[model samples]
Target: EPEVTQTPSHQVTQMGQEVILRCVPISNHLYFYWYRQILGQKVEFLVSFYNNEISEKSEIFDDQFSVERPDGSNFTLKIRSTKLEDSAMYFCASSRDRVDSGNTIYFGEGSWLTVV
Candidate 1:
């Protein structure tokens, strides 16, 4: 099966600093998403992008968070100002089609971010 890939499997950063986590979704997938799991907590959706625009976002994805598709293959998530509560495992996901259309979302191993 195809998969999404994320970089910097683990990173430690100071609070208030900025961080960018990178991802490469499956080559043919059209929808991209960013999800994060706080230690021992449920996975939460941050944002979703399709056709170069944000399709939806959760309250957790405030002004501090951003996503970008810089090229055909790369999708990235940027945290403008990291906070202690922002520490989590960020998972990049992709779907070949819309969820309502019966497509399954594939997730990457995840990039672990630890804020100090």
Candidate 2:
């Protein structure tokens, strides 16, 4: 089965530096989303994109963050300036079903970000 994949399962960066996390979502799926979990916290939604534009976004998706579908299979999330508080497990998910059903969303193992 096709599955979502993320690179560099863990990332370490200095505060204020820019970082880009990469993902390869499941092929043939239409909806994509980014979510983060700060160590012990509940997973929080960052953004969702479809049809090449953002469909939904949470407050955490501030100016410092942006996402792109650089190619047919790759999706990327860029953080303009990393902060210590930004450290977390970033997950990439995709679903063929609509958001209302919430069944198709499949999450990657996660890319752990650490800022110091």
Candidate 3:
């Protein structure tokens, strides 16, 4: 079976630093997304990417945050200036179907980001 894989399993940086989280989804699937999980809180959707543009995005995905599907295989999220509140576990996900459809979304182990 195929699964999503993320690089730099754990990342720590000072406040105001830049961070980039990378992911590779299942080879044959489409509809990619990024979700954030703050400690002890419900998972929150950050941004959704499809057909090379943003399909949906939450408030948390502000100017400080950006996403890209470079080379059509790897998806990346870049945080321009880290903040203390930015500390969380970021998950990379994908599905064969659209968000409203009854399709299974696969999640990566997560790229943990901590800001000090």
Clashing residue pair totals per candidate (backbone < 3 A): 0, 0, 0
Model 3 global lDDT (CA atoms, 0 to 1): 0.94
lDDT of 3 by residue, 1-116 (tens): 89999987999999999999999998887899999999999999999988889999999999999999889789999999899999999999999888665888999999999999
Please report the candidate that would top lDDT against the real structure: 1
Deviation (Å) of 96 in candidate 3: 0.9
Worst 10 residues of 3 by lDDT: 95-104
TM-score top scorer: 1
Ranking of candidates on lDDT, top first: 1, 3, 2
Instruction: Write down the worst ten-residue block by lDDT for model 1.
Output: 96-105
Candidate 3, residue 116: how far the Cα is off, in Å: 0.8
- Residue 103 shift from truth in candidate 2, angstroms: 4.0
Give all TM-scores, in the order shown: 0.97, 0.96, 0.96
User: Runs in model 2 with CA error above 4 Å?
Assistant: none
